[model samples]
Target chain A: MKKIESIVLAADLAGTAVFALEGAIVAMRHGLDLLGVMVLSFVVALGGGVIRDLLIGATPPNAVRDWRYPVLAFVTGLLTFVFHDTARALPFMPIMTLDAAGLALFAVAGAQKALDYRIGPFIATLMGTVTGVGGGVVRDILLARVPMVLAADIYASAAFVGAVVLVAGRRFGLSPMLAALLGGGACFALRILAVMHGWQLPKATPW
Target chain B: MKKIESIVLAADLAGTAVFALEGAIVAMRHGLDLLGVMVLSFVVALGGGVIRDLLIGATPPNAVRDWRYPVLAFVTGLLTFVFHDTARALPFMPIMTLDAAGLALFAVAGAQKALDYRIGPFIATLMGTVTGVGGGVVRDILLARVPMVLAADIYASAAFVGAVVLVAGRRFGLSPMLAALLGGGACFALRILAVMHGWQLPKATPW
Candidate 1:
């Protein structure tokens, strides 16, 4: 139990860092103030988990209950605000890989949490995907872009697959850590491959 | 107890109808399919309550549990989808009045529910306002418009006031029915008056 708890916290914090950087950079690009940058950073980092928790009836969402999350998010935001050019200059491949890893961890951990709440497997899978993609969706909407997950990318689809695998592993008696690793690995791999191959959903052909 | 439940349900359904109509029209303007219209309609109508319930740890939210709510929302959407022009031709004043009443009921009922969950008063007021405007905000985001609540409008402000009144009345031992009437009346009056007088939040001056 301790191992599982630590693993989840680690995943959450790591994911928070990745998204916070992206959110802060976007805020700077939009010409928002420091406060706006911090707020968007926090929202991008933890909005998904909060939404997932609410759906599963986990009140006082972790983002609010734990000081570490907001602190890390704001600190990351402040740093990004101060060095926006550097953050923007981050190499695309590395950030993309980190983003994929974050997505995988969030999916696996979120599915596990949903199962702990005794939700049905199907909905739990959805919860996992939501945990992975919800924050980014909100950020995109705030920026007035079509949510990336709703766009051509296979991002949420990868999360969905990871969630399914995690749920299935648990149903088949796999240990939590093992299941998480397998699920997360699958998601990470799929996202990377999708990016490398430029895989995307088929667009509706112009009539 | 039964009285309270029915009253809340009435408010929920009534608000759902008003929001569903608004969502349907927006979807139509975007040229969404029938399915898209229905889905957006459901989201707009029930999203606020769903978000409120999640924050208060109400699992499997009432919107999901009560068939009546979704059924009514979808039916309204379907009718709007078919008779869109007629719905669009609705007199402005009547629709605006109905929208205000719906906002009032949602604010009062949502705050009461938050109080029932024993959330702090300040947060409970926020929950009530979220219940009044969260769905519309989401709808706007999907439509790529700045959320009206975050824009220059007295809408969410009125909801906040209504929620505060409701919570305060309950704290002072007001009867549930009386508290509901007092809070709802205040919200309705404020929103209508603000609309009539073109009240808005101050805008920033351009340099």
Candidate 2:
């Protein structure tokens, strides 16, 4: 049990860090000042989990009660604030890979949390997809951009698939760790593939 | 006690209806189809309360658990979808008045709920402001506009003022009904005045 907890914690923290970085990058792209960058990073890093926890009646969300996550997010934001230009100059593939990783971890974590709260599997899967995509949605909204999930490549779809996989694995008696690995791997791979192939949801015809 | 409850309920329902109409109008302006219109109306009507409920550990957010809110929102959306052209042609004053009323009701309702949960006055005030402005924020973001609260006029300020008034009234032993009335009236008046005068928040100097 301790080992599983540790693994989950590690994954959650890693995902938070990566999402914060992505948020910081977006803030820089928009030429937001220091405060805006940090705010964006913090929201992107923890917004999804907070939303999930709130929906599940987990008050004082882990993101809020657990100091470590905010500390990590703020630190990452500060670093990004200081080195945004350098980070932007780095190859794009690494950033994309990090984002994919964050998506997978958040999806698995959200589903697992919902299951722990004894929510129905369907709601759990939806929660997981929300957890994976909610932060990015908030970030994009704050930046005055249409959420990429609604318009871009198969982002929410990957999260939905991963969440369903996790829920199915749990129903079939797979260990939590194994389920997470399978689900996260699926999300990551699907997102990467979608990016590679330029896959996209059908756009509504302009009136 | 029942009277207060009824009053709150009435105000909440009215706010929901107005927000749904506003959301539908925005959707039509953007040329969204039926599904998009319905989605926006739902989000704009219920999003603020849902956020408040989640933050305060109110499970199954009243917006989602209670069938009435969704029904009302969807009905408004349908009506708007069918008569969008006519609605758009109507003079803007009635719409603005409805919006001001919503801002007032939502602000008071949010603060009252927070107080019911025994939250600190400061947090309650913040929650009230969030509840008042949140749905509109979501609407603007979905429409790919910068949130009016962050970029535009004295929108959030009016909410904040009303929230503070409620909190102070409560602190001074005012009845909940009276406080709500006072707060809501203040918000409605201030918002109307702001609109009439074209009041705006000072913009940050462009970098």
Of the true interface contacts, the fraction found in model 2 is 0.26
In candidate 2, which residue pairs get closer than 3 Å at backbone N, Cα or C atoms, i.e. clash? none
**Segments of candidate 2 deviating more than 4 angstroms:** B1-42, B52-57, B63-137, B144-207
TM-score (chain B) of candidate 1? 0.94
- Model 2, docking class: incorrect
What TM-score number comes out for model 1? 0.62
Q: What is the DockQ score, from 0 to 1, of model 2?
A: 0.18
| Tens-digit per-residue lDDT, B90-144, candidate 1 | 8989888999998998888899999999999889999999998888887777777
RMSD of 1: 6.7
Off by over 4 Å in 1: A1-8, A202-207, B1-42, B52-60, B63-137, B146-207
DockQ comparisons of all candidates to the true complex: 0.14, 0.18
State the iRMSD of every prediction, in order shown: 6.0, 4.7
* Model 2 C-alpha lDDT per residue in residues A54-164, reported as the tens digit of each score: 777777788889999999999999998898778788788998998898999899889998899877786788679889988888898788776756545778888988999
True contacts kept of each: 0.21, 0.26
CAPRI grade of model 1? incorrect
